[model samples]
Target: MDRTVVSVLFCFVSYVFQLASTEKNVYNFNGGWETDESKMLARPGICNIDVVDVSKQTFSQKHFEDYYAYVKPVIIKGSTDNTKFRKLCEKTALLERYGDKIVRLSSANTHSYSKRDVELKKYVNEIMKPQTLDTLGNETYYWFGDNDYVEFADLFDQYKAPPYKLPNMHGVYSFGLAAAGTGVPFHFHGPGFGEVIFGRKRWFLYPPEKQPSFNPNKTTLHWLMEEYDNLHQLDKPLECTINEGEIIYFPDRWWHGTLNIDTSVFISTFLG
Candidate 1:
């Protein structure tokens, strides 16, 4: 290579790195990255009821049958076996062990693909809170997900995970916690199951064949407050409220969103 060309390339790479460093210092604090302020969001149609709940005593292969045969969602009451996690999931227990660790928090707004990092103790004791009438998603509630798989493995090591999974698919575990009224917005990926270990959660789902018409910038809280009840009777979604010890199964490519009805400790098994 020509010496002049090599020198110019080196200079360009150095400039790019310098620019990135400057931006990081200007825009972030406490191991942070981007905030939802500079992100886009989504609009929505509505929420309705169309999910099944089965008791653990009667839970069967038929539930699995329905899950795959119809690609329908099901809530299996008393289905979770997270005995150890339940004991270790309380605020004090988590803070005692993982307080100083850094966690990544995704904005709980539709299509707002931004994340920030903060200490776990700060989120538990300072940031997360139950929603009050005065505040909604606009106040910036962050949803914690995939908090360093390796770093937190010990925490989940004794957790008895959901027994059933999509056939022939490998299950990858993700654990998360969020404040009341906070949740991930509409999105879809490979099949998965989510279980709330310590609080209530409300889910809104749409099958893969029926793509929901929604704004890309609205948060789930905003949609729930403004559009959920007003949705046309004919266009309602498959909705369900799951309590602790219940698990919800959603199929591949299905659009689903969740709202924690309480400060929630949850885990998911994503099949791939």
Candidate 2:
């Protein structure tokens, strides 16, 4: 063979080998966290067990010691009065001023304003547009309207029991409003707290143990939807149509989502 031809062949082979090496590194970097497999296993004893009814019992230190390690989530009812809740809901001056604008979930269903729901439908329609998922970043946007967070904190301050300190900071206690004929996209809470949904909406909760397998490096929403779709049959979700003054507590790491049956406003508090 000619020397020039031999040199060209050698260069081609070297280029191909370098490309393969780059691809392998990329795969390994992405898969390293996913493949360990054991972290995803559900730890059954980590949640604090307490009665869901506030009239019955509040979450005490004793309750935390006994069941906190084993129970993953708990929902509490009868935590506050309706009149106070209504007052907070009515205090959405910022939201009303913002008109129809919000940060929306990626790939969510688009709602129409003229769908016979109510005036709130226009606001809902504006917020549910598609966007890309950036890992749970600190960028906060209004789910309902601008004042939603303010109203939510006010309600949380009034309703949360003693020792459940309301944060002096904004966004600690937040409000979400869902219009009729829509739902919040599936998602999980951030670290250090669970969520309390206050309103008359149907909520669905999925436990990690119920999943086929677990992947701890990933968020709860990923596992919950995977199991929910594959299982085909939903375990009867803890469904509650919370009234004006009622609140439901879901412990941290509990996978939850909601659908709005009616135009609803809710205040969610995250307790550390």
lDDT of each: 0.69, 0.42
**Tens digit of per-residue lDDT, candidate 1, span 29-104:** 2112112322212222233443444542555666676645246777666655666777787667777889998888
Top model by lDDT, which number? 1
- Number of the top candidate by TM-score? 1
Q: Which stretches of candidate 2 lie over 4 Å from their true place?
A: 1-51, 56-61, 68-70, 91-171, 191-199, 209-239
Query: Model 2 reaches what TM-score against the true structure?
Result: 0.46
Q: How much is the lDDT of residue 109 in candidate 1?
A: 56
Clashing pairs in 2: 40-216, 45-69, 45-70, 46-68, 46-69, 47-68, 47-71, 48-68
Model 1 misplaced regions, further than 4 Å: 1-63, 66-70, 131-141
Distance from true position, residue 108, model 1, in Å? 1.5
**lDDT, model 2, position 255:** 57
Clash totals for all candidate models: 9, 8
For each candidate in turn, the TM-score is: 0.74, 0.46
Report residue 235 deviation for candidate 1 (angstroms).
Answer: 0.4
